[model samples]
Target: MQDEDRRRYHDLRPDWAESYIRLERAASLIRTYEVQFVPGLLQTPDYARAVLSVVHDDPGEVERRVGLRIRRQALLDAPGGPRLWAVVDEAALRRMIGGRELGRAQLDHLVALAERPNVKVQVAPFHFDGHAAAGGPFTILRFPDRDAPDVVVLEQLSGALYLDKPSDVEQYRRVMDRLCTQVEPLDRTAAILRAIRAEL
Candidate 1:
Protein backbone atom coordinates (compact mmCIF):
# COMPACT_ATOMS: atom_id res chain seq x y z
CA MET A 1 0.00 0.00 0.00
CA GLN A 2 1.11 3.57 -0.68
CA ASP A 3 1.46 6.34 1.93
CA GLU A 4 -2.10 7.49 1.39
CA ASP A 5 -3.26 3.91 2.01
CA ARG A 6 -2.01 4.05 5.58
CA ARG A 7 -4.33 5.27 8.35
CA ARG A 8 -2.82 7.74 10.79
CA TYR A 9 -4.49 8.08 14.19
CA HIS A 10 -3.42 11.34 15.84
CA ASP A 11 -3.17 15.04 15.10
CA LEU A 12 -2.42 18.40 16.71
CA ARG A 13 -4.68 20.39 19.03
CA PRO A 14 -8.41 19.96 19.78
CA ASP A 15 -9.10 18.61 16.31
CA TRP A 16 -9.78 14.93 15.57
CA ALA A 17 -7.21 14.74 12.79
CA GLU A 18 -6.34 11.06 12.97
CA SER A 19 -9.95 10.00 13.29
CA TYR A 20 -10.74 12.02 10.18
CA ILE A 21 -7.93 10.20 8.36
CA ARG A 22 -9.51 6.91 9.37
CA LEU A 23 -12.80 8.27 8.09
CA GLU A 24 -11.15 8.95 4.74
CA ARG A 25 -9.66 5.47 4.56
CA ALA A 26 -12.32 3.14 5.94
CA ALA A 27 -15.67 4.75 5.23
CA SER A 28 -17.46 3.02 2.36
CA LEU A 29 -20.80 4.49 3.33
CA ILE A 30 -20.59 7.75 5.25
CA ARG A 31 -23.69 8.79 7.19
CA THR A 32 -23.54 12.12 9.02
CA TYR A 33 -26.00 14.01 11.23
CA GLU A 34 -25.14 17.68 11.64
CA VAL A 35 -27.07 20.24 13.67
CA GLN A 36 -24.51 23.00 13.23
CA PHE A 37 -22.77 24.27 10.09
CA VAL A 38 -22.59 22.16 6.94
CA PRO A 39 -20.55 18.97 6.98
CA GLY A 40 -16.96 19.56 5.91
CA LEU A 41 -17.43 17.30 2.91
CA LEU A 42 -20.31 19.46 1.69
CA GLN A 43 -19.07 22.95 2.68
CA THR A 44 -18.19 25.59 0.14
CA PRO A 45 -14.68 27.08 0.39
CA ASP A 46 -15.99 30.33 1.86
CA TYR A 47 -18.21 28.47 4.26
CA ALA A 48 -15.30 26.32 5.30
CA ARG A 49 -13.14 29.36 5.89
CA ALA A 50 -15.85 30.90 8.04
CA VAL A 51 -16.15 27.76 10.13
CA LEU A 52 -12.39 27.34 10.49
CA SER A 53 -11.71 30.96 11.43
CA VAL A 54 -14.02 30.61 14.39
CA VAL A 55 -11.22 28.72 16.17
CA HIS A 56 -8.04 29.69 14.39
CA ASP A 57 -6.97 33.32 14.04
CA ASP A 58 -4.20 33.00 11.48
CA PRO A 59 -5.30 33.35 7.88
CA GLY A 60 -2.46 31.08 6.69
CA GLU A 61 -3.46 28.25 9.01
CA VAL A 62 -7.12 28.64 8.15
CA GLU A 63 -6.38 28.33 4.45
CA ARG A 64 -4.26 25.26 5.08
CA ARG A 65 -7.09 23.62 6.99
CA VAL A 66 -9.52 24.59 4.25
CA GLY A 67 -7.28 22.87 1.71
CA LEU A 68 -7.20 19.79 3.88
CA ARG A 69 -10.98 19.83 4.15
CA ILE A 70 -11.40 20.17 0.41
CA ARG A 71 -8.94 17.33 -0.10
CA ARG A 72 -10.87 15.07 2.26
CA GLN A 73 -14.01 15.66 0.20
CA ALA A 74 -12.26 14.32 -2.88
CA LEU A 75 -12.96 10.82 -1.55
CA LEU A 76 -16.63 11.30 -2.38
CA ASP A 77 -15.65 11.50 -6.04
CA ALA A 78 -13.04 8.78 -5.95
CA PRO A 79 -13.78 5.64 -7.95
CA GLY A 80 -15.59 2.98 -5.91
CA GLY A 81 -15.26 4.99 -2.70
CA PRO A 82 -17.79 6.04 -0.10
CA ARG A 83 -21.28 7.36 -0.80
CA LEU A 84 -22.37 10.17 1.56
CA TRP A 85 -25.82 10.26 3.17
CA ALA A 86 -25.91 13.45 5.24
CA VAL A 87 -28.90 14.59 7.29
CA VAL A 88 -28.47 18.28 8.03
CA ASP A 89 -30.71 20.19 10.39
CA GLU A 90 -32.77 22.99 8.85
CA ALA A 91 -30.99 25.37 11.21
CA ALA A 92 -27.72 24.72 9.42
CA LEU A 93 -29.35 25.69 6.14
CA ARG A 94 -30.74 28.94 7.56
CA ARG A 95 -27.75 29.90 9.74
CA MET A 96 -26.07 32.21 7.16
CA ILE A 97 -22.60 31.26 8.38
CA GLY A 98 -20.33 33.40 6.22
CA GLY A 99 -22.97 35.86 5.06
CA ARG A 100 -26.10 35.90 2.93
CA GLU A 101 -24.29 35.43 -0.38
CA LEU A 102 -22.04 32.73 0.99
CA GLY A 103 -25.07 31.07 2.56
CA ARG A 104 -26.86 31.06 -0.78
CA ALA A 105 -23.80 29.55 -2.46
CA GLN A 106 -23.66 26.90 0.20
CA LEU A 107 -27.29 26.03 -0.42
CA ASP A 108 -26.61 25.93 -4.14
CA HIS A 109 -23.70 23.63 -3.46
CA LEU A 110 -25.87 21.29 -1.40
CA VAL A 111 -28.64 21.23 -3.99
CA ALA A 112 -26.17 20.48 -6.75
CA LEU A 113 -24.38 17.75 -4.82
CA ALA A 114 -27.65 16.04 -3.91
CA GLU A 115 -28.25 15.45 -7.59
CA ARG A 116 -25.58 12.74 -7.53
CA PRO A 117 -26.93 9.20 -7.21
CA ASN A 118 -24.45 8.38 -4.42
CA VAL A 119 -25.07 11.52 -2.41
CA LYS A 120 -28.22 11.62 -0.27
CA VAL A 121 -29.14 14.89 1.47
CA GLN A 122 -31.96 14.93 3.99
CA VAL A 123 -33.14 17.91 6.02
CA ALA A 124 -34.14 17.53 9.65
CA PRO A 125 -36.76 20.16 10.35
CA PHE A 126 -37.44 21.80 13.73
CA HIS A 127 -41.02 20.52 13.92
CA PHE A 128 -39.98 16.95 14.68
CA ASP A 129 -41.01 17.52 18.33
CA GLY A 130 -37.59 16.36 19.52
CA HIS A 131 -35.72 13.36 18.07
CA ALA A 132 -33.08 10.74 18.79
CA ALA A 133 -30.23 12.83 17.41
CA ALA A 134 -30.87 15.55 19.96
CA GLY A 135 -27.56 14.66 21.54
CA GLY A 136 -25.53 16.48 18.85
CA PRO A 137 -23.71 16.04 15.52
CA PHE A 138 -21.99 12.76 14.74
CA THR A 139 -20.78 10.59 11.90
CA ILE A 140 -21.28 6.85 11.61
CA LEU A 141 -18.63 5.36 9.37
CA ARG A 142 -19.30 1.99 7.76
CA PHE A 143 -16.52 0.10 6.08
CA PRO A 144 -16.64 -2.44 3.25
CA ASP A 145 -14.87 -5.14 5.24
CA ARG A 146 -17.30 -7.26 7.23
CA ASP A 147 -15.13 -7.49 10.33
CA ALA A 148 -14.32 -3.80 10.58
CA PRO A 149 -17.64 -2.82 12.15
CA ASP A 150 -19.06 0.72 12.27
CA VAL A 151 -17.25 3.69 13.90
CA VAL A 152 -19.06 6.64 15.44
CA VAL A 153 -17.43 10.08 15.64
CA LEU A 154 -18.59 12.82 17.99
CA GLU A 155 -16.93 16.22 17.99
CA GLN A 156 -16.71 18.15 21.19
CA LEU A 157 -15.61 21.64 22.18
CA SER A 158 -11.99 20.59 22.82
CA GLY A 159 -11.57 17.26 21.03
CA ALA A 160 -13.52 14.35 19.58
CA LEU A 161 -14.65 10.90 20.60
CA TYR A 162 -14.33 7.86 18.37
CA LEU A 163 -16.60 5.05 19.47
CA ASP A 164 -15.88 1.65 17.96
CA LYS A 165 -17.52 -0.84 20.32
CA PRO A 166 -20.58 -2.67 19.06
CA SER A 167 -22.95 -1.20 21.64
CA ASP A 168 -21.95 2.40 21.13
CA VAL A 169 -21.87 2.04 17.38
CA GLU A 170 -25.27 0.37 17.40
CA GLN A 171 -26.74 3.23 19.42
CA TYR A 172 -25.55 5.76 16.87
CA ARG A 173 -26.87 3.57 14.07
CA ARG A 174 -30.30 3.72 15.63
CA VAL A 175 -30.12 7.51 15.87
CA MET A 176 -29.14 7.73 12.21
CA ASP A 177 -32.05 5.54 11.22
CA ARG A 178 -34.46 7.68 13.21
CA LEU A 179 -33.00 10.83 11.69
CA CYS A 180 -33.37 9.50 8.17
CA THR A 181 -36.98 8.65 8.84
CA GLN A 182 -37.82 11.94 10.50
CA VAL A 183 -36.17 14.21 7.95
CA GLU A 184 -37.92 15.40 4.86
CA PRO A 185 -37.70 13.12 1.82
CA LEU A 186 -35.07 13.82 -0.82
CA ASP A 187 -37.37 15.66 -3.21
CA ARG A 188 -38.85 17.71 -0.41
CA THR A 189 -35.37 18.54 0.84
CA ALA A 190 -34.42 19.80 -2.62
CA ALA A 191 -37.44 22.06 -2.70
CA ILE A 192 -36.76 23.33 0.81
CA LEU A 193 -33.15 24.06 -0.08
CA ARG A 194 -34.22 26.06 -3.10
CA ALA A 195 -36.69 27.98 -0.99
CA ILE A 196 -34.04 28.76 1.59
CA ARG A 197 -31.70 30.00 -1.13
CA ALA A 198 -34.38 32.31 -2.40
CA GLU A 199 -34.82 33.80 1.03
CA LEU A 200 -31.05 34.37 1.24
Candidate 2:
Protein backbone atom coordinates (compact mmCIF):
# COMPACT_ATOMS: atom_id res chain seq x y z
CA MET A 1 0.00 0.00 0.00
CA GLN A 2 1.05 3.59 -0.52
CA ASP A 3 2.36 5.73 2.33
CA GLU A 4 -0.83 7.74 2.07
CA ASP A 5 -2.88 4.65 2.81
CA ARG A 6 -0.79 4.09 5.90
CA ARG A 7 -1.43 7.62 7.00
CA ARG A 8 -5.14 7.20 6.40
CA TYR A 9 -5.14 4.10 8.57
CA HIS A 10 -3.71 6.08 11.44
CA ASP A 11 -6.14 8.90 10.82
CA LEU A 12 -9.16 6.58 10.88
CA ARG A 13 -8.48 5.01 14.26
CA PRO A 14 -10.28 6.39 17.31
CA ASP A 15 -7.95 8.30 19.61
CA TRP A 16 -7.85 5.41 22.08
CA ALA A 17 -7.17 2.78 19.41
CA GLU A 18 -4.55 5.04 17.94
CA SER A 19 -2.81 5.20 21.34
CA TYR A 20 -2.76 1.41 21.63
CA ILE A 21 -1.53 1.06 18.04
CA ARG A 22 1.40 3.29 18.88
CA LEU A 23 2.40 0.97 21.72
CA GLU A 24 1.58 -2.12 19.66
CA ARG A 25 4.09 -1.18 16.97
CA ALA A 26 6.71 -0.46 19.60
CA ALA A 27 6.18 -3.47 21.86
CA SER A 28 8.64 -6.32 21.74
CA LEU A 29 6.15 -8.81 23.07
CA ILE A 30 2.36 -8.79 22.65
CA ARG A 31 0.26 -11.09 24.81
CA THR A 32 -3.46 -11.29 24.21
CA TYR A 33 -6.38 -13.25 25.68
CA GLU A 34 -9.55 -13.18 23.62
CA VAL A 35 -12.89 -14.58 24.80
CA GLN A 36 -15.18 -13.57 21.98
CA PHE A 37 -14.23 -13.18 18.31
CA VAL A 38 -10.71 -13.70 17.03
CA PRO A 39 -8.15 -11.17 18.21
CA GLY A 40 -7.78 -8.28 15.75
CA LEU A 41 -4.08 -9.03 15.24
CA LEU A 42 -4.91 -12.57 14.13
CA GLN A 43 -8.18 -12.04 12.24
CA THR A 44 -8.63 -12.93 8.55
CA PRO A 45 -9.77 -10.23 6.13
CA ASP A 46 -13.24 -11.70 5.52
CA TYR A 47 -13.66 -12.39 9.22
CA ALA A 48 -12.67 -8.85 10.00
CA ARG A 49 -15.20 -7.52 7.51
CA ALA A 50 -17.91 -9.72 9.01
CA VAL A 51 -17.11 -8.26 12.41
CA LEU A 52 -17.14 -4.62 11.29
CA SER A 53 -20.38 -5.11 9.38
CA VAL A 54 -22.31 -5.73 12.60
CA VAL A 55 -21.78 -2.15 13.80
CA HIS A 56 -20.94 -0.33 10.59
CA ASP A 57 -23.44 -0.20 7.70
CA ASP A 58 -21.18 1.64 5.34
CA PRO A 59 -19.39 -0.85 3.09
CA GLY A 60 -16.66 1.64 2.37
CA GLU A 61 -15.92 2.08 6.05
CA VAL A 62 -15.86 -1.65 6.66
CA GLU A 63 -13.41 -2.14 3.82
CA ARG A 64 -11.22 0.60 5.17
CA ARG A 65 -11.14 -0.99 8.62
CA VAL A 66 -10.43 -4.42 7.13
CA GLY A 67 -7.56 -2.96 5.14
CA LEU A 68 -6.10 -1.49 8.30
CA ARG A 69 -6.39 -4.75 10.26
CA ILE A 70 -4.74 -6.80 7.51
CA ARG A 71 -1.97 -4.29 7.17
CA ARG A 72 -1.31 -4.44 10.91
CA GLN A 73 -0.91 -8.23 10.69
CA ALA A 74 2.16 -7.80 8.48
CA LEU A 75 4.21 -6.83 11.50
CA LEU A 76 3.93 -10.40 12.78
CA ASP A 77 6.11 -11.56 9.91
CA ALA A 78 8.28 -8.52 9.57
CA PRO A 79 11.94 -8.66 10.58
CA GLY A 80 12.42 -8.25 14.33
CA GLY A 81 8.66 -8.33 14.81
CA PRO A 82 7.15 -8.60 18.26
CA ARG A 83 6.59 -12.10 19.57
CA LEU A 84 2.85 -12.81 19.73
CA TRP A 85 1.28 -15.08 22.33
CA ALA A 86 -2.48 -15.42 22.30
CA VAL A 87 -4.85 -17.55 24.37
CA VAL A 88 -8.16 -17.73 22.54
CA ASP A 89 -11.24 -19.05 24.26
CA GLU A 90 -13.02 -21.95 22.52
CA ALA A 91 -16.12 -19.76 22.32
CA ALA A 92 -14.40 -17.61 19.71
CA LEU A 93 -13.84 -20.63 17.47
CA ARG A 94 -17.43 -21.80 17.93
CA ARG A 95 -18.89 -18.35 17.25
CA MET A 96 -18.12 -18.76 13.51
CA ILE A 97 -18.23 -15.30 12.01
CA GLY A 98 -18.86 -14.71 8.27
CA GLY A 99 -20.42 -18.19 7.93
CA ARG A 100 -18.75 -21.61 7.99
CA GLU A 101 -16.38 -21.18 5.09
CA LEU A 102 -14.93 -17.95 6.42
CA GLY A 103 -14.73 -19.33 9.94
CA ARG A 104 -12.95 -22.44 8.72
CA ALA A 105 -10.44 -20.35 6.85
CA GLN A 106 -9.87 -18.26 9.93
CA LEU A 107 -9.16 -21.32 12.07
CA ASP A 108 -6.83 -22.66 9.40
CA HIS A 109 -5.04 -19.33 9.44
CA LEU A 110 -4.62 -19.57 13.20
CA VAL A 111 -3.18 -23.06 13.02
CA ALA A 112 -0.72 -21.96 10.33
CA LEU A 113 0.36 -18.93 12.30
CA ALA A 114 1.13 -21.04 15.35
CA GLU A 115 3.86 -22.78 13.38
CA ARG A 116 5.96 -19.64 13.47
CA PRO A 117 8.55 -19.59 16.24
CA ASN A 118 7.60 -16.12 17.37
CA VAL A 119 3.88 -16.80 17.44
CA LYS A 120 2.03 -18.85 20.04
CA VAL A 121 -1.67 -19.69 19.82
CA GLN A 122 -3.55 -21.63 22.46
CA VAL A 123 -7.14 -22.44 23.23
CA ALA A 124 -8.94 -22.33 26.55
CA PRO A 125 -11.08 -25.43 26.18
CA PHE A 126 -14.79 -25.24 26.85
CA HIS A 127 -14.36 -27.53 29.83
CA PHE A 128 -12.43 -24.99 31.78
CA ASP A 129 -14.24 -23.62 34.83
CA GLY A 130 -14.26 -19.98 35.98
CA HIS A 131 -12.21 -18.40 33.20
CA ALA A 132 -9.41 -16.27 34.60
CA ALA A 133 -10.15 -13.30 32.40
CA ALA A 134 -13.89 -13.33 32.85
CA GLY A 135 -14.02 -9.57 32.52
CA GLY A 136 -13.49 -9.65 28.73
CA PRO A 137 -10.72 -9.47 26.16
CA PHE A 138 -7.50 -7.63 27.01
CA THR A 139 -3.88 -7.40 25.82
CA ILE A 140 -0.56 -6.65 27.43
CA LEU A 141 2.20 -4.98 25.45
CA ARG A 142 5.80 -5.27 26.62
CA PHE A 143 8.80 -3.48 25.22
CA PRO A 144 12.42 -4.65 25.17
CA ASP A 145 13.65 -1.42 26.66
CA ARG A 146 13.75 -1.65 30.42
CA ASP A 147 13.09 2.05 30.62
CA ALA A 148 9.78 1.51 28.87
CA PRO A 149 6.83 0.31 30.93
CA ASP A 150 4.42 -2.47 30.01
CA VAL A 151 0.82 -1.54 29.25
CA VAL A 152 -2.56 -3.26 29.26
CA VAL A 153 -5.26 -2.57 26.66
CA LEU A 154 -8.91 -3.13 27.43
CA GLU A 155 -11.13 -2.82 24.37
CA GLN A 156 -14.70 -1.67 24.74
CA LEU A 157 -17.65 -1.09 22.41
CA SER A 158 -16.90 2.48 21.31
CA GLY A 159 -13.39 3.11 22.59
CA ALA A 160 -10.40 1.55 24.43
CA LEU A 161 -8.67 1.77 27.82
CA TYR A 162 -4.93 1.82 28.37
CA LEU A 163 -3.35 0.83 31.72
CA ASP A 164 0.23 1.85 32.34
CA LYS A 165 0.60 1.98 36.09
CA PRO A 166 2.92 -0.69 37.51
CA SER A 167 0.18 -2.07 39.72
CA ASP A 168 -2.35 -2.13 36.90
CA VAL A 169 0.11 -3.73 34.50
CA GLU A 170 1.13 -6.25 37.12
CA GLN A 171 -2.48 -7.24 37.77
CA TYR A 172 -3.05 -8.04 34.12
CA ARG A 173 0.30 -9.79 33.95
CA ARG A 174 -0.77 -12.14 36.70
CA VAL A 175 -4.06 -12.71 34.98
CA MET A 176 -2.27 -13.54 31.74
CA ASP A 177 0.02 -15.96 33.53
CA ARG A 178 -2.92 -17.74 35.09
CA LEU A 179 -4.85 -17.59 31.86
CA CYS A 180 -2.07 -19.29 29.91
CA THR A 181 -2.08 -22.09 32.43
CA GLN A 182 -5.73 -22.76 31.68
CA VAL A 183 -5.27 -23.16 27.93
CA GLU A 184 -3.87 -25.98 25.85
CA PRO A 185 -0.18 -26.09 25.04
CA LEU A 186 1.41 -25.39 21.64
CA ASP A 187 1.14 -28.94 20.23
CA ARG A 188 -2.41 -29.36 21.42
CA THR A 189 -3.26 -25.89 20.17
CA ALA A 190 -2.72 -26.91 16.55
CA ALA A 191 -4.64 -30.13 17.02
CA ILE A 192 -7.52 -28.30 18.68
CA LEU A 193 -7.64 -25.78 15.83
CA ARG A 194 -7.77 -28.49 13.16
CA ALA A 195 -10.42 -30.38 15.08
CA ILE A 196 -12.52 -27.21 15.31
CA ARG A 197 -11.99 -26.57 11.59
CA ALA A 198 -13.26 -30.04 10.81
CA GLU A 199 -16.48 -29.30 12.67
CA LEU A 200 -16.84 -26.02 10.86
Candidate 3:
Protein backbone atom coordinates (compact mmCIF):
# COMPACT_ATOMS: atom_id res chain seq x y z
CA MET A 1 0.00 0.00 0.00
CA GLN A 2 2.83 2.36 0.89
CA ASP A 3 4.66 1.55 -2.31
CA GLU A 4 1.52 2.19 -4.36
CA ASP A 5 0.94 5.53 -2.70
CA ARG A 6 4.59 6.40 -3.32
CA ARG A 7 4.36 5.54 -6.98
CA ARG A 8 1.20 7.55 -7.41
CA TYR A 9 2.82 10.81 -6.41
CA HIS A 10 6.51 10.29 -7.17
CA ASP A 11 6.41 12.02 -10.54
CA LEU A 12 5.00 15.50 -10.84
CA ARG A 13 2.23 15.39 -13.40
CA PRO A 14 1.03 18.42 -15.40
CA ASP A 15 -1.83 18.91 -12.97
CA TRP A 16 0.61 18.75 -10.06
CA ALA A 17 2.79 21.34 -11.72
CA GLU A 18 -0.21 23.65 -12.03
CA SER A 19 -1.04 23.06 -8.40
CA TYR A 20 2.48 24.01 -7.45
CA ILE A 21 2.05 27.32 -9.24
CA ARG A 22 -1.19 27.96 -7.40
CA LEU A 23 0.44 27.00 -4.11
CA GLU A 24 3.29 29.44 -4.58
CA ARG A 25 0.86 32.25 -5.28
CA ALA A 26 -1.63 31.37 -2.55
CA ALA A 27 0.70 30.63 0.34
CA SER A 28 0.80 33.45 2.86
CA LEU A 29 1.96 31.42 5.87
CA ILE A 30 4.17 28.35 5.77
CA ARG A 31 3.85 25.91 8.63
CA THR A 32 6.27 22.99 8.53
CA TYR A 33 5.65 19.89 10.64
CA GLU A 34 8.85 17.90 10.51
CA VAL A 35 9.58 14.55 12.15
CA GLN A 36 12.89 13.27 10.79
CA PHE A 37 15.00 16.39 10.29
CA VAL A 38 15.13 20.15 10.51
CA PRO A 39 13.09 22.08 7.94
CA GLY A 40 15.12 23.38 4.97
CA LEU A 41 14.33 27.02 5.76
CA LEU A 42 16.09 26.65 9.13
CA GLN A 43 19.22 24.93 7.82
CA THR A 44 22.53 26.78 8.01
CA PRO A 45 24.89 26.97 5.06
CA ASP A 46 27.39 24.65 6.69
CA TYR A 47 24.66 22.21 7.63
CA ALA A 48 23.13 22.26 4.17
CA ARG A 49 26.51 21.83 2.55
CA ALA A 50 27.25 18.77 4.64
CA VAL A 51 23.89 17.24 3.75
CA LEU A 52 24.22 17.93 0.02
CA SER A 53 27.81 16.72 -0.10
CA VAL A 54 26.79 13.15 0.59
CA VAL A 55 24.48 13.19 -2.43
CA HIS A 56 26.36 15.26 -4.98
CA ASP A 57 29.51 13.74 -6.46
CA ASP A 58 30.79 16.99 -7.94
CA PRO A 59 32.02 19.55 -5.43
CA GLY A 60 31.33 22.44 -7.82
CA GLU A 61 27.68 21.51 -8.31
CA VAL A 62 27.30 20.89 -4.61
CA GLU A 63 28.47 24.42 -3.88
CA ARG A 64 25.97 25.79 -6.39
CA ARG A 65 23.09 23.87 -4.81
CA VAL A 66 24.05 25.00 -1.32
CA GLY A 67 24.21 28.58 -2.52
CA LEU A 68 20.75 28.23 -4.04
CA ARG A 69 19.39 26.87 -0.77
CA ILE A 70 20.81 29.83 1.13
CA ARG A 71 19.20 32.20 -1.32
CA ARG A 72 15.89 30.43 -0.98
CA GLN A 73 15.87 30.97 2.78
CA ALA A 74 15.76 34.70 2.13
CA LEU A 75 12.09 34.40 1.20
CA LEU A 76 11.29 33.73 4.86
CA ASP A 77 13.06 36.96 5.77
CA ALA A 78 11.64 39.04 2.95
CA PRO A 79 9.58 42.05 3.87
CA GLY A 80 5.83 41.27 3.88
CA GLY A 81 6.55 37.65 3.10
CA PRO A 82 4.67 34.70 4.48
CA ARG A 83 4.98 33.84 8.16
CA LEU A 84 6.93 30.63 8.91
CA TRP A 85 6.34 28.10 11.63
CA ALA A 86 8.40 24.94 12.11
CA VAL A 87 7.93 21.96 14.41
CA VAL A 88 10.98 19.72 14.51
CA ASP A 89 11.68 16.40 16.11
CA GLU A 90 14.24 16.25 18.94
CA ALA A 91 16.24 13.70 16.97
CA ALA A 92 16.88 16.35 14.32
CA LEU A 93 18.64 18.50 16.86
CA ARG A 94 20.52 15.51 18.26
CA ARG A 95 21.74 14.28 14.88
CA MET A 96 25.42 15.16 14.40
CA ILE A 97 25.22 15.91 10.72
CA GLY A 98 28.23 18.20 10.71
CA GLY A 99 29.71 17.37 14.11
CA ARG A 100 29.01 18.95 17.49
CA GLU A 101 30.07 22.43 16.48
CA LEU A 102 27.86 22.51 13.41
CA GLY A 103 24.98 20.89 15.24
CA ARG A 104 25.24 23.49 18.00
CA ALA A 105 25.35 26.25 15.42
CA GLN A 106 22.27 24.88 13.71
CA LEU A 107 20.38 24.70 17.01
CA ASP A 108 21.44 28.24 17.82
CA HIS A 109 20.24 29.33 14.40
CA LEU A 110 16.83 27.76 15.04
CA VAL A 111 16.65 29.59 18.36
CA ALA A 112 17.37 32.84 16.59
CA LEU A 113 14.71 32.17 14.01
CA ALA A 114 12.20 31.42 16.74
CA GLU A 115 12.70 34.98 17.95
CA ARG A 116 11.27 36.44 14.77
CA PRO A 117 7.66 37.52 15.12
CA ASN A 118 6.72 35.80 11.91
CA VAL A 119 8.46 32.56 12.78
CA LYS A 120 7.50 29.97 15.38
CA VAL A 121 9.59 26.96 16.40
CA GLN A 122 8.42 23.97 18.38
CA VAL A 123 10.23 20.74 19.18
CA ALA A 124 8.74 17.28 19.72
CA PRO A 125 10.69 15.60 22.48
CA PHE A 126 11.85 12.00 22.17
CA HIS A 127 9.62 11.05 25.07
CA PHE A 128 6.44 11.40 23.04
CA ASP A 129 4.59 8.18 22.20
CA GLY A 130 4.30 7.07 18.57
CA HIS A 131 1.56 8.83 16.64
CA ALA A 132 0.22 9.44 13.12
CA ALA A 133 3.45 11.16 12.07
CA ALA A 134 5.29 7.89 12.67
CA GLY A 135 4.87 7.49 8.93
CA GLY A 136 7.53 10.15 8.13
CA PRO A 137 8.25 13.85 7.65
CA PHE A 138 5.60 16.11 6.12
CA THR A 139 5.09 19.87 5.70
CA ILE A 140 1.85 21.84 5.62
CA LEU A 141 1.74 25.25 3.99
CA ARG A 142 -1.21 27.44 4.82
CA PHE A 143 -2.40 30.57 3.09
CA PRO A 144 -3.89 33.79 4.33
CA ASP A 145 -7.15 33.08 2.59
CA ARG A 146 -9.07 30.30 4.29
CA ASP A 147 -10.79 29.54 1.02
CA ALA A 148 -7.55 28.54 -0.61
CA PRO A 149 -6.59 24.91 -0.35
CA ASP A 150 -3.69 24.07 1.95
CA VAL A 151 -0.65 22.37 0.49
CA VAL A 152 1.06 19.37 2.05
CA VAL A 153 4.57 18.36 1.02
CA LEU A 154 5.88 14.92 1.91
CA GLU A 155 9.52 14.00 1.50
CA GLN A 156 10.82 10.60 0.47
CA LEU A 157 14.07 9.04 -0.75
CA SER A 158 13.13 9.76 -4.36
CA GLY A 159 11.81 13.34 -4.10
CA ALA A 160 9.03 15.59 -2.81
CA LEU A 161 5.36 14.65 -3.08
CA TYR A 162 2.89 17.50 -2.88
CA LEU A 163 -0.72 16.98 -1.73
CA ASP A 164 -3.36 19.56 -2.60
CA LYS A 165 -6.42 17.32 -2.62
CA PRO A 166 -8.82 18.73 -0.02
CA SER A 167 -9.32 15.41 1.75
CA ASP A 168 -5.60 14.62 1.74
CA VAL A 169 -4.70 18.06 3.01
CA GLU A 170 -7.26 17.77 5.80
CA GLN A 171 -5.85 14.43 6.85
CA TYR A 172 -2.36 15.89 7.10
CA ARG A 173 -3.72 18.89 8.96
CA ARG A 174 -5.19 16.60 11.60
CA VAL A 175 -1.88 14.78 11.84
CA MET A 176 -0.11 18.12 12.24
CA ASP A 177 -2.44 19.11 15.04
CA ARG A 178 -1.63 15.90 16.86
CA LEU A 179 2.11 16.38 16.36
CA CYS A 180 2.00 20.01 17.43
CA THR A 181 0.20 19.07 20.62
CA GLN A 182 2.98 16.61 21.39
CA VAL A 183 5.77 19.19 20.95
CA GLU A 184 7.17 21.43 23.62
CA PRO A 185 6.09 25.05 23.62
CA LEU A 186 8.26 27.56 21.75
CA ASP A 187 10.07 28.75 24.85
CA ARG A 188 10.75 25.20 25.98
CA THR A 189 12.04 24.31 22.57
CA ALA A 190 14.48 27.18 22.78
CA ALA A 191 15.58 26.00 26.22
CA ILE A 192 16.11 22.51 24.90
CA LEU A 193 18.39 23.89 22.21
CA ARG A 194 20.29 25.92 24.78
CA ALA A 195 20.80 22.84 26.95
CA ILE A 196 22.03 20.91 23.94
CA ARG A 197 24.45 23.71 23.16
CA ALA A 198 25.78 23.55 26.71
CA GLU A 199 26.28 19.80 26.44
CA LEU A 200 28.27 20.36 23.26
> What are the TM-scores, per candidate, against the unseen true structure?
0.91, 0.95, 0.84
lDDT string, candidate 2, 45-100, tens digits? 99999999988999998999999989888889888889999999999998967899
- Candidate 1 at residue 198, lDDT? 92
Structure candidate 1, residue pairs in collision: none
The pairs that clash in candidate 3 are none
- Candidate with better lDDT, 1 vs 3: 1
Q: Write the per-residue lDDT of candidate 1 for residues 90-187, one digit (tens) a residue.
A: 89989977889999999999999999988999998877888789989999889998988888988788777889999999989998998788778878
Clashing pairs in 2: none
The candidate scoring highest on lDDT is 2
Q: After aligning candidate 1 to the native by TM-score, how far in Å is the CA of 104 from where it should be?
A: 0.3
The C-alpha local distance difference test score for the whole of candidate 1 amounts to: 0.84
Best by TM-score: 2
Note the Cα lDDT for every prediction shown: 0.84, 0.88, 0.75
TM-score of 3: 0.84
lDDT of 3 by residue, 1-200 (tens): 13553344334324554454346445788777776567877899999988888777888777766765675577776777778878888887888887999988888899898898988898877888775578878778788877777889875665569888999999988987877776787778778889878887
Rank candidates by TM-score, best first: 2, 1, 3
